[model samples]
Target chain A: MTDTRNLGSQTSLPTKKLKFHKPKIGTAIFLTVWSIYVLIPFVIMFNIATMTPHEALQPFAFGWDEGIQFKAFSELFVDLCMGFTIFGAFLNTLMYSIPPVFIGITVGTMAAYAQSKLTWHGRDFTFGYLMFCWLMPDCVGMGAGYMWFDFLGWTGTPLPFMIPGMFCGVAQVFFLKSFMSTIPNDLLAAAKVDGLGDVMVFWKIVFPLTLPAYWCQIIFAFIGAYNNYLGPLIYLEDPATYSLQLALRFFSVFNKDNKPAVMAGNILAVIPLLIVYLCFQDFILKGINMGSGLKL
Target chain B: MEAENVEALEGVQAEIVERQRKRRKTVKIIKQDIIGWLMGGWPFIGAMIFGFIPSIIGYVLPFMELHTFDYSQMEFVGFKNFEWLLFNERSMFWLALKNSLYYTVSVPIYLGIALFVAVQLDKHIKGTGAFRVIMFLPTFVSSVAMSIFWQFMFDKTGGFNSILGLFGVAPIDFLDDELWFMPSVIFTGTWGACANSVLFQAALANVDISMKEAARIDGATERQTFWKITFPMISPTTFFQMLTSLVGALQVFTSLQLMARTDTGPNGAAVSVVLYMYNMAYQWTGPDYGLGMAGACGLMYQTVLVILTLIIFKTKKRWVHDND
Candidate 1:
């Protein structure tokens, strides 16, 4: 969001030789078609989300001719939110989401610091461990993970989702490690010379610098935690603890005939993600660039 | 003789002092290792429980007959569950295995589409930022939301067919029909191509313009210049993106699950291995084909993935440009 045109402009340097870099008519047409194709789903979602059931049933039809407006959303928040309101579900999701992301990133950054910035004997061995674990396919351990969580009495709670995340995946560590490599060794060495310890080095120096890199993963991990369906679906049995996804799933299951309300729920579920993205998109691009060792 | 004895004593004393200093250095290295492990390695506690242990169990559990979480009822089943997969007609494993394999391998087709778009946007454009955002908008939305959107669109009389009806064409059943299942998955994925294209964008930005400029001036066509100059630089990104996309697509759940009511699409066409296993783990009412059966299926799929991953990494030298 912060920058864009200068990015794509880099490769086409020869075009800069001219005063007018006339965008091809063909390109404009192609972009317009592509944009429409991409935007159609969003358009349909919004249009249908706001529509009355009758209006929604007619796919391309648009009319406010009958029934009260925003009725579907009202019913959604009122009659059919399954034990949790959309807001409650949102709160439940946040409760389930934030701790792990906060803990994970902190631990991940610290670990990444250890991997890339510090000197240690087992650094390369730990790197190998992270790579091996990162490549491990998930869900095969469904029985074991479930049994383990049950054994710990963590199945119904957020612990299953939260605690496991603190370790962070190889992807997060790898990206952060790559970004941290760009951190000059002498910079940390100089900090050490000034009597900064590992914790202090992380707090006062590395954290602020790595914020750009962390932002990318933070958004990804946060959205991932929020949008996680299977974990919540399996673990949380009580209606009181249903996340937005669970709430939506139940609502849609019983209320499939109420298409607009379901769509409204879907719309509400997506808003937080959209806000997170709109706010942090620049960081995502910048972070990816910096993380991947691009010219930052 | 007294002078010689004093010199020898000094030499021995120096050696002892040197040994102490070396021990101190080793101690310091060990201290750093402890600190590093505390910071980074502690998370492996959770990884061990949630990741490693389960993976180990994943391999071993397939050999057992403890269907439910009641580990007390465990029994050795050997290759019986694996045999059931091959022999049983009721087993959804066949179609599911076919679907997952095709879905995972078809990544290059969708990736090529994203790369094509990335290439288009890179050609000296201005004010294309809005388009970039629109393209990427779907990735930002939760997959559940995106899945719901696609679900409605692919509904028999939903948006896609409605649009088709306007063109004097027969309305197509994008969801219920098995033939359009993979196409629907690929089509739905195109909205999120913005996610895949971002890396390519970075790769293109990093491409050295001077090399391309040199080739262009020497009568190389745009396509020729791309192949010779721009492509070699971006192939690494392509390789990395492809690997991640394959892994991610293999675990396809929330999206495909949402698109169809049965959550597997028509005849399990959109059903991925993870979803298929999920049914066994929970939904499928079989004390017979419970979590143990799912484990066997999951173990098989994971082994294939691990093998595929190794093959890809081994063959990296073939495709990935070694500019570094």
Candidate 2:
């Protein structure tokens, strides 16, 4: 249907029409260097993970007995002292992360649904208030959160992490609510006429439609809670209740007795997140489109 | 009289039916309202307490001296901590603020370079997805791991300086030097933040092709099209990135914490405001809870950020384009 002769000229006309062109040789060279720059750190991390401390320190000249220190992983799982182990830290992180995921999703969905579906006065003001939470730095209120948690007798408990996390879950609500708004209003009306209540509508109709975004929020909340070092560092005094990030920080320092193991431990700790991102890269992009600024 | 009685009975029946229907409608509406509230209520309540309350408390606490061990000992410090922050040479607050500024400057410079590289890959170049994945890989890597990797790389005789020798540049002590310390951390941090730039590049890809074509047809150069057309479309994304980057730069702890060797670093060369706050609260053997809470200062931090946000928002009308 189209003219083939014009196609080439149509696309190339801009460049051909122009008299001057900036040279891309500099750009090409820069790309090469930048690619290498991005790659080298990752390559070095992988290399260090696979080698002993003594061997890792060796000038990364490729051929050095093909050293592999896979035992450092087992050491993390095996080593325990005075009721503290790497597994305990992993569990602690899970404890800190899981509640917030549930609570954040729960609270965020409610606020979003209220804002989107309900006819309440000052709804916009409520949303503006929530957005203020996202705008302010989280650390600004840490001292206060710490004091409040202490007052509630929940300093060392998982409640401190989960409670504050729910408050900060406005981002998720913002994402889910916006996604919820895109749903056809007719479907909701139909359901309402069929005698379905709002809760059933949210659960059966709205929530199902939003599962993808919900999952994305879940993953985000989990990772954020998982990687939170400062919260646990301040609120959690008991080493038994320390998060994975805290443990990793601890291991990086206190494990001076076993440096290779620490490096290997670092690799192991990060692998699960890599696995998650690799699997959900597409969803992450979709999630980003839905909630642009909230991406950590 | 019999006809009048029949008419009255009919009227009564009609009225009964109307009342029943009205009741049913009211009940249904009420039920729906309850379900909606229940579905969303707990989260809102939780947010009100933990989310809203602490922010108010954060503002209020800075003016008053707070002690965890002794709650009754509260007194109005009345900007004494701020005075200490401004005039006290021993306090690392000003230095930390300086470091944060330097860190903030690195964001635009690095993001610009990263955006430039990303545009190259965005040309539907071979293995674009793979390159994206590789670039994004560092973002997934834990800050701990990334910091450790940097520490190893710059360890006095490590490959960083060794590689510098290839360019005939002498080995400069990175971790120890006061000038180089923050810059080295910033450089390492910017290396991994390429993910944000790539994401921005993807957003740029979504930019309307017609505008770009129009620019091209108008005898505009590629650079001109990019500056006038493409960049404006992506301004919202850039603004979003800048906000997050500013917040992140202000709260910089992990990289500095790691590089400064939380245990071994000097008396506050690499100590950020956050790290200082941490030290004041927990790190010291006895832990100066009062001083820490005094210094866990929010007013200046909030004031500066709020001002920055206002400036950006005010200027946004000029730069940020909303297609809608």
Candidate 3:
């Protein structure tokens, strides 16, 4: 006991190890207000989701009215076709999201490899031009895409939405390029000396190495393609071809009276994203965390 | 063994040179280039055809008039569309333009506040991640979803009024009144904008912690550190947010479209540019496609955005810091 006390005294050194940083009153107040401000919509949505349609349509009250209305979920499923069948829209989202995810990852890997590995002429210039194109407002090309698709007589089809979404994004190229640049050039040289063909080196070696960046590109491509509104809004004239967002837009149409069920629909629409966020929480956050940092 | 290795190296070098020489031959180079082009070609071709070429067409279309749907019977109207838009008092162009400006100017303010909120969440406080996720929930919620939520929140008998009641303040008409329309739009807009704030937070986290420590040790206040050090470090992100925000502001379609049913203040109040364009093109039977095209004019907007970007880039020295 005496030896333990002596050892503890030696380590303590009669100095305070922890220093507290005082929290500012102004910031505390501001954060409280900001937190409430951010919580308002979520509270409203969460409350509305539980309220009966009549209660929802009724003047808002502070406390819970008639307990929870879990029937909204069943109602949404039942009236699915009334406001773009939630299941169909969900399927449509998957269909739209999958192809771009694959194409973005594949083509992004190839382009990034060419830019980083190949000493081909005009590589930097080409890459820079692509980045420039990425900066252009998506709306600038939107109307033109509509006109072009109209001329092609492919306006109402899913092709316009899916194909352009698959191949056209420059953000993926920029992302993958930054990732590929980090790979050591010595690896490529060694692989070449080992008699690996360019294609073999890429597929067998370089491709496997860039999986993290590939996942990043996949998540981005999936989200962007799935949430696409303006393209489908313009190019797709058929109701049947309506994307989930477009389907949701049908709910916002306040013809005779407001459809509060659409609020339920909106809440339900976000369910898929929540699932995605939960499943790929790490990749989504990591992707976003790294995306802006590596812009150079 | 050394000699054999040298000879092997020499043979490899010769083979490489011969291949390079063959690659230099015009025909062979052209063939290989075609293959290369094909491999890297789809995206470029798609971008040019779908994006570049079409924009060029769109740019020139306002200068010409399609008298009918016939390609052969087109007449060049020169600047008539521009004249119609600029000088025509009957058109809703000025009102829409004003509304568009309102939308554009509100973004920086919204985004500024958003950044501040983001900074607060990034302070490593308890429940910050949960708050970030909750705030970000609205972003994943579609605009249609946003409109629904806002409609409920801002309803006369809605949450806005209830909150107002708690403070003993009378309810105000949010959606119907012209004076309140843009503010309501901005309010709804800010609700869904928390995702962007989280993105800023993410960017801020990536900022070198050492710099913050250095600033702290130098006795800089929190505000000073934010403005002098943190702000400059995250300027790239700020610029990106500004650019995207501007683009989103200019294309303010859905919100305006939803809000259109509500009565405008006396003489045509709440119509935005895209709404006005839609109204002209589709609302009336004598569809003034030319007039609609004039109102849907993107070139001026594009030029302004491009110039703003260039200006920002040029003046980046004042704010942006890239630590080598």
Candidate 4:
């Protein structure tokens, strides 16, 4: 494991060890204020989520007065003539998001494995083409995608959102390719010599070796899919098919009278991602470092 | 004589086995090549269909005067769409373009704040890890959620204004006022500044400690040591961060869309180019497909501009230190 706790201590200076160095008072004060600024929204969101609507409208105060109204959390599950419940939107989000990420990872890994390990005609050309495509602004393709989807009568369906994701994601492919490149070609050659098929070699050797890359891609894919508002907004007209983002937006807009419920829904929308980030913070940080380092 | 013959026979058999193994290896190589093709081909086809083909279509779209997705109806209009976008009295394109470019001002602000905090955290202060997590927490939240949360905070009777009221100042209409709208957007834009700082922190950590020690031993103060040694060492990372952040800022849509709530806020003051494109394509009064396509073409030009800027910046690699 990286010495994340002692990041500054990696220096060779014996006298300037991180553990021994006392941080200046100015630095401490700045960090404290910054942290408060960063965290206050979340604290207030949760705090307001536990309050009644009337109390929520009041200037932000901490703690529960009437024993933390769990009503909004429960009420989110109960459909309020808003065409769909929060639970249903969550499920729709999962349905729309999961398949694409699954396909993206699989296709991205396969392509990366091929580009990194296997020799094939046009491999370099294909890699270059994909990189170019990746660098192109998303808007460049989005208009055409909208037209294409409309042409195909796939506009109202989840096909528009899922189909693109089922393809190789550029970032995932690049990250995994770089990771896979680090694994010696000799190991793969040995595996082939052992009578293992290409698929078996990938599953047994290459895939296992690139688990960190996969973890990073998976987390990113999940977050991207979950937080996707633009996709669902453009594609889906049915409220039942709306992702949590759309649903939350709709709820907040129409149900302006209920602040606590809106806050509760916001918290619900945020918690899963928060948990994923908290759990895999190390991998995420390492992945970012690896990405930046690769650019360098 | 019989023993010698037996040894020669065994040698012949061993050679035959080795030749067979070599033949099998060549066949396996062919098979692996086929597998590689199959593995790479699927995504290549997908990219062609979804990525390249659509981009080409989008590029061609602005030149055509088509009301709908029907290609049969498309009339080649030449530079008319471009002319309309540039010179038309009703076009919001210029305003959107200006606002979008203005949004990039936040990139340096974000980077500066992030770098400062990162330097502070790099000092190995107590509970820096906790501070790091707290700071980065906002980044993981959805843009919509963050916008909504900020909407509450920026409300006239909201917590932010209430606090200002305590200080005997009039409540600022952050979202409503044209003057304050961009600032509000920029302020909310900085909520996830810590994400960049995390990357900066990592870069700072990986800076050559020996150089820092040399500077310190030579009587360089902490600030000087940082400015002279550490900053130059991490300039490459700073460049990367700035590039990505600029790209992201130019594509600023979600926060503006959600915060502004409807129609780009107070005479389109907060209208980003992407948001403008989205509205043109999806939510405009008549859904002018040509105009939408023109907006997309505009976005492409902006992207090209960004890439060119990046290429220019990349030429400054002479200033970037390679620690390795």
Best model per lDDT: 4
- Which CAPRI quality tier does the interface of model 1 achieve? acceptable
Sorting all predicted structures by TM-score, with the top scorer first, yields: 1, 4, 2, 3
**TM-score, structure 2 vs. true:** 0.86
State the weakest 10-residue window (summed lDDT) of model 3 chain A. A1-10
**Candidate 4 structure quality by residue, lDDT tens digits, B205-286:** 8887877765555455788878877898788788777776777788888878898956879878978878877777667645
True contacts kept of each: 0.48, 0.33, 0.29, 0.51
DockQ ranking of the models: 1, 4, 2, 3
- In model 2, what lDDT does residue B305 have? 74
lDDT against the true structure, each candidate:
0.76, 0.69, 0.66, 0.79
In the order shown, what is each candidate's alpha-carbon RMSD?
Answer: 5.1, 4.9, 7.6, 6.0
Q: Which of 3 and 4 is the better model by TM-score?
A: 4
Put down candidate 2 lDDT per residue, B90-204, tens digits, no spaces. 6666877776676677777767766776677666555566666766666666677677667767766666887887788888778887778877888887777667766677677
Reference-based TM-score, model 4: 0.88
Give the C-alpha miss distance for residue B189 in model 1, angstroms: 1.6
Docking class of 4: acceptable
- Model 3 stretches with alpha carbons more than 4 Å out: A1-20, A23-43, A62-64, A78-84, A138-142, A254-260, A294-296, B1-35, B67-74, B127-138, B166-170, B206-218, B262-270, B278-287, B290-296, B321-324
Interface RMSD of 1: 6.1
Question: What C-alpha lDDT, on a 0 to 100 scale, does residue A223 get in candidate 3?
Answer: 68
Error of 3 at A217 (Å): 2.2
lDDT of each residue in B133-193, candidate 3, tens digit only: 6566555556666676676677778778878877888887677677777787777776666
C-alpha DockQ of every model? 0.37, 0.33, 0.26, 0.36
Chain B: TM-scores of all predictions: 0.89, 0.85, 0.80, 0.85
